[model samples]
Target: MDHIRRLLGRVTAAALTLLGVSVLIFAALRAMPGSYTELVLGPLATPEQKASAAASFGLDRPVAEQYGHWLRNTVTGDFGTSLVTRSPVASEFADRLPVTVTLTVLALALTLLIGVPLGVYTATRAGGGRGGAAGRLLSAFGMSLPEFVLGSLVVFLFTRYRLGLSVGTYTPWSEGPLASAGSLFLPACVLAVFCTAATARTTRDAVLGVLVEPHIAAAVARGEPKGFIVRHHVLRNASVPVLTLVATLSAYLLGGAVIVERLFDVPGLGSYLVDGLDRRDYAVVQAGVLLAATVFITANLLVDLLSGLLDPRLATAAKGAA
Candidate 1:
């Protein structure tokens, strides 16, 4: 019952957050200093033509009514039509979302695979002294670089030194899965740098803290295999914090994805969103932001639920509060 209540509460909060975000997006777009009317028609369009276009696009409607109608349509994946292109935002998303999804998932997988093992290895070494020192050096440098700078630097190195690498061309899955994967590899690596550095540092600290516990000391004193102790005890407890970090990072990753996608010239949601903003296309901007909000809310809720499941004390706390 407590778990159910907690889940309900989380969903309610997410819905409310999503609503607030949509309201802000709507208001901000309307507040911008450009005429959506002129954008759709032409600068040379007559006043009569501008008024007609505004009415047709619901710009003449009350702001509240326009928002309500848009929200209603958006719920069904309609999301209205782009003023600039006169095509459905949903269609654009259908065409571009998969690339962003693939890049994000691939980068996250690479981050975990690289970060966790290295973190565990370093944490096992003298309270994170020698190994952690080396990791910290890399993490500090990697984290210090902004996403665009890192992407540019990486692209430069790959093109200048590496062989058979295409810098700006994004291959589609229609070519072949391997070809598609090959195209995404560099962009994924670009994204993974930040995630890997941050995740590794956090995991190292978490595991290092856990290694000093009395039970852990006893396991070590008994001359148990270091691998067994680290694998069974260290990862289990350390995972809660590491998972939290990963969950938080997922939201931040979207911002980086936008930069990485543009840098690689990928036909993804990032580029779509950028084009909308550049053209001041309200439908595209609103739909894109709403989609991002939905992803964040869903991912955050899953992380919370999983955290409770993995650490029963969290569930117990919720029950007590209930």
Candidate 2:
């Protein structure tokens, strides 16, 4: 009951959060100084032409009324025509969102495969071993580098060696799965590096904390087998935190993919976002912001619900706090 209640509360909160974001974005964009009509329709456009353009897009209305129309239309999958491209924003998003989704999914998979086991290895050997030492250094190293610089370096290395990276092309899975993978793999690695480091460090710390508990030490002194100890206690207890870290890192993957996508020349939402903002394409910018906010809140809500379900202690804590 508590879990369901918490989930319901968060879901409701997420909806409100998204609404607030859309309103804020609308206010901020509309609040910018200068005549939006002049900007969109061009400075040289006559008063008649500018008024017609504003009226056509319903921008001639009061801000609140315009926002109301936006809310209604956005809910129904109509983002309106782009001011710059004069294209339907829905069509633009349909072409772009999937590419980003695929890229982030690949990066996250790589993060888990790299971080989890290495973290376990370091935690299991924290007393003193090369695994702990090396993992610590590597994680620190990854954290130190900027993501764009890292992407650039990867591009340089891969392209210099003619490693079949093919940085300037985006192939869809429908075309050829292997070709698509090859195209995205390098950029995904560039994006995944920080997530990998963070997850490893977080996992290592969680496991180390678990390993130091009196019960864990007691089991160790009682001649418990290493695999048995790890499976039964270390992983079972430590996994809650590891799961939380992974969920948190997912946001970073989404945000970082923009720069990586730009570097790789991939036709994803990130590039669309950058281009829209640069050109002041209102529909594209609005759609990008709403889509990103939705993804972020939804991911976080799922993470919280899953955490609550997987960890009985969280329920107990909530009850106590109540």
Top TM-score prediction, candidate number: 1
Instruction: Compose the digit string of candidate 1's lDDT tens values, residues 1-322.
Output: 6667778898999999999999999999999887787665668999999898888888998999999999998888789998887888888888887778778878889999988887777677645367767877877777787989989987888778866778888888778878888899889888898889888888889998888889899998999998899888778878888888787667656533788888888888887888888778999999888878887778778878887878788788878877
Model 2, TM vs. native: 0.91
In the predicted model 1, the residue pairs found to clash are none
Q: lDDT of all the models against the reference?
A: 0.83, 0.81
Worst 10 residues of 2 by lDDT: 247-256
lDDT tens digits, residues 6-87, model 2? Answer: 6688789999999999999888777666555776667888999989978887778898888888899999989988887789
Clashing residue pairs, backbone N/CA/C < 3 A, model 2: none
TM-score of decoy 1: 0.92
User: How many clashes would you count in candidate 1?
Assistant: 0
